[model samples]
Target: MNPTATALRAGVRRGVIELRQSLTNGADLWNHAFWPVLMLVVTYFLRDVSFGRTGFTVGALALPGILGMNAAMAMVTMSQLLTADREDGTLLRAKATPNGMLGYLVGKIVHVSGGLVVDLAIFLVPGLFLVPGLVTGSPDAWLTLAWVLALGMVAALPVGAVLGSVFSSARAQGLLMLPILGMIAISGIFYPVTALPGWVQWVAQVFPVYWLGLGMRSALLPDAAAAVEIGESWRHLETVGVLTAWAVLGLVLAPIVLRRMARRESGSSVARRREKSLQRAGM
Candidate 1:
């Protein structure tokens, strides 16, 4: 039997176990339910609020955009888990074993992706009932959703891995959130990007978050809703191209970055980290 293959199988099992634990854990279950429920409530209140008399409710518009943002957030979640693991010596231990880092990477992806799917369903199923003016019946709607989600995960998770490898601690990782929030502000997660300044639109275009939101809107909104988007079009080709580019970049960088980060960590460093953590807790 191939050793790497065996490692991968172990990863799969580990990821499945962790995913199940997330489902059962009280804190995890609350986290899983909270955002989606909040969004559902918002969607319900805004269900009748029209977007510029176009007959499309703001609620409907927000649904897919929120979905996109949630999908893109997989990157952040991956980074969070990775950084936490490193701080706790998981990364160092994984490095000591043959193919352990590979397995660890695979496991994290599985856990993140699976959790994302479940969260998406939690928001979307109820959202569909509250938000109307969507192109729900079209076969193209679902196909677009499927491919956008697939590309989104590929584009996001590996970049997250790279980020996790770079940030030294949870405090350092928190800095990443400032830029992320700025991106979300301009990325049209809750409103039309077309309403923002043209230069701002250009800035948003450079990131995957904008494209992810665009892709989701394209999937769920009616064709006429494209008028509300920049370029007055869905720009599916551009979305695919940009996300694919990001996917390629992330895939190329994650392994090299992970290897570098792992090589830099020693048992003593990990022990020091644990000691600091204990000291902080005692304080």
Candidate 2:
């Protein structure tokens, strides 16, 4: 067998093990359920409220956007896990093995993407019941949903890996939440972006979050719903173009960044980081 092929198989096994551990562990299971449940509760309350004269409830309109936002958030999950792994010397251990970085990255992608699919199912299955006006019966709708999700992950995860490599510490990774939250606020996740100021709309369009939301809305909503969007269309081409650009950028950058970060990992450095963390915890 080819060395890379061997590493790939090991990576797949690593990812499956990690994903199973997450599903079976109490804390991880809670983490998976918490956000979706909270979002469902919020949507339930808003389900009765109308979105202007569009005849769609606020909750219905928000559901697909919420799904997209959560899918895009897989990037954050990948980033945080990468940082945690580095802090705990997992990266260092991988570096010591043959083609370990390749295996490690493949494993990370599989786990993160797999976990994302689970999270989406958690939200979408109940969401269909709780929210109205979603076109669930069409083959086209599902096809749209499938591509948006696949591309969205491709765009997000590599960028997330790059971010994780850059942050260097758990504390630093936490700071990333603020900007992400800010982006969500402007990304039309909870409301129509056309309603926001022109500058805000432009800023929102610059990122993947808005496009993801738009893509989801395109997938799940009625044709009339496009009237509420900018340009009165789904703009599928733009969505594909923007997300593909990000995917390319991230794919190009992640390896360079990860390799650089991995080069700096050593037994002494890992031990020092562990010592510092223990000291901070007063343990």
Candidate 3:
């Protein structure tokens, strides 16, 4: 096996064990699962809110968007978990071992990957039973769904890693919430881009979520051309291009930032800061 794959697999095995523990312990999953499920469910409800149209079928339009949104949320959650590990010194411990840092990050990818798989299943299974008309009836639609979902995860990973490195502080995690939530709100994940304000539409063009939603729409409803911001001018090329660019940029930048952060590490300084905080808290 290739070295990277071998390293990744070893890391993933460790991560899988940790994930199982967390799942059984009802730790982060309980708290984090809510936001993702809520975001998708609320978007689904909004899509079908109108009562007057018979066979209006908003579900089909919503599936691809929800899947994309869920992938983004899962990635964000994974990044935050990594940050938590860093703050608590788990990452530091990993770094002391050979390729331990690589393994640890690989483990995180494996763990989050599992979550994304679960998220896809949850999104699709419900769409099939709860919104039968919305589920893509063709093999082509299934292919599209699979492609978009995998692409979404690939697109989210680099950003997640960068965010995890940048926001090493636990408190910084809270600040990230607004921007992510806001991005989803304006990205037309729940509505058509044409219906959003011009400024919001322009803003959405800069991010992967919009591209993801557009890509999904392309596969799910080929005739709903007006719904996409670029509207088949390049088919899904714009989305693919923008997302791939972000992924590449993030891949280059994340490790540099992480290395910088690692260099600043001092166990003594961390201990001093912890003690100061404890004193301030009367702990």
**Top lDDT model:** 2
TM-score of each: 0.97, 0.99, 0.85
Q: What lDDT would candidate 1 get against the real structure?
A: 0.92
Give the poorly placed runs of model 1, Cα more than 4 Å off: none
Selected candidate, larger lDDT, 2 vs 3: 2
Report the error of model 2 at residue 137, Å. Answer: 0.4
How high is the lDDT of residue 280 in model 2?
A: 93
Angstrom error of the Cα, residue 229, model 2: value is 0.5
lDDT of each: 0.92, 0.94, 0.69
lDDT digits (tens) for residues 1-283 of candidate 2 = 7999999999999999999999999999999999988998898888899989988788988999999999889999999999999999999999999999999999999999989899889889998988878899999999999999999999999999999999888878889999999999999999999889999999999999999999999999999999999999999999999999999999999999999999999989889988999999999
After superposition, the stretches of candidate 3 with alpha carbons farther than 4 Å from their true spots are 1-6, 36-59, 225-234, 276-282
Number of the candidate with higher TM-score, 1 or 2: 2
Better of 1 and 3 by lDDT: 1
Kindly report which residue pairs in candidate 3 clash with one another.
none
Winning candidate number (TM-score): 2
